[model samples]
Target: MRSLLSKVAVGLVFVFGGGLWAASAVADDVAHKVVIQVSTDDERTQKIALNNAVNIQKSLGVDEVKIEIVAYGPGLGLMTTAGKQSQRVADLVLQDITFSACNNTIKKITKKKGAAPKLVEGVGIVDSGAVRIIELQQQGYAYIRP
Candidate 1:
């Protein structure tokens, strides 16, 4: 009977202790977060920012990272439908990456061009890209400018 009880205790420990270990492992695997800023009009700079985001997502498993790219000023063009990177942006959006366009920049462009720029599908609009970057940083997201 004592031997039976010892075996039972060992089984319980393996079950319960293993559960706790798994839970702590999941907790330690907290998703990595980052907010990338792109305020340059240079196409090369914009592509570099996109590449940085992709590389980070790849280094960490896609499901283990959250990434947001904020574009304002001259960089706002990168999020527009007519932008050279529009197709790539769309592809990245499908992979769970976020793209933000500044409404303030859109308004300025509208006033200058008589119409607001058309954003690529899945692009989110923020009141200001700078403010969005600050908000993300306050929320513990690492900031990147690439």
Candidate 2:
């Protein structure tokens, strides 16, 4: 009877422990995550990055991937409400692609222009664009610069 009870207890541990391990593995397995960095103010570069993001989503399926675009320096201009590409940015946001603007850049621009630039709706502000890219890379996100 003692041997039988021990065997049952061991089986229970294996069943529960295996279940926990499987759950943890599933949680850690992300399909794909990409962080695209844009530091130049060139409209061509900005448009290329945006096209790359759309292509990635189309190739991988929107639900199978995550994408973030971090803009700083002159690139932050792309996120401004008055930017020529603001409408395109807004459209991309609706598709689950995220856009981040550097707060440091905003401060510098504000100091020079005497006012903070208006950001399009849904644009996130981060303390630093480069740092944000680093953090995302550390979290296993793939990095791209166009």
- TM-score for each model: 0.80, 0.84
What value does the lDDT take at residue 14 in candidate 2? 100
Model 2 misplaced regions, further than 4 Å: 1-30
For candidate 2, what is the lDDT?
0.94
- The sequence of per-residue lDDT tens digits that candidate 1 reaches over residues 1-146 is 99999999999999999999999767646478899999999999999999999999999989888999999999999999999999999999999999999999999999999999999999999999999999999877999998
Model 1 residue 7 CA deviation (Å) reads 32
lDDT of 2 by residue, 38-126 (tens): 99999999999999999999999998888999999999988999988999999999999999999999999999999999999999999
Specify the highest-TM-score model's number: 2
lDDT of each: 0.94, 0.94
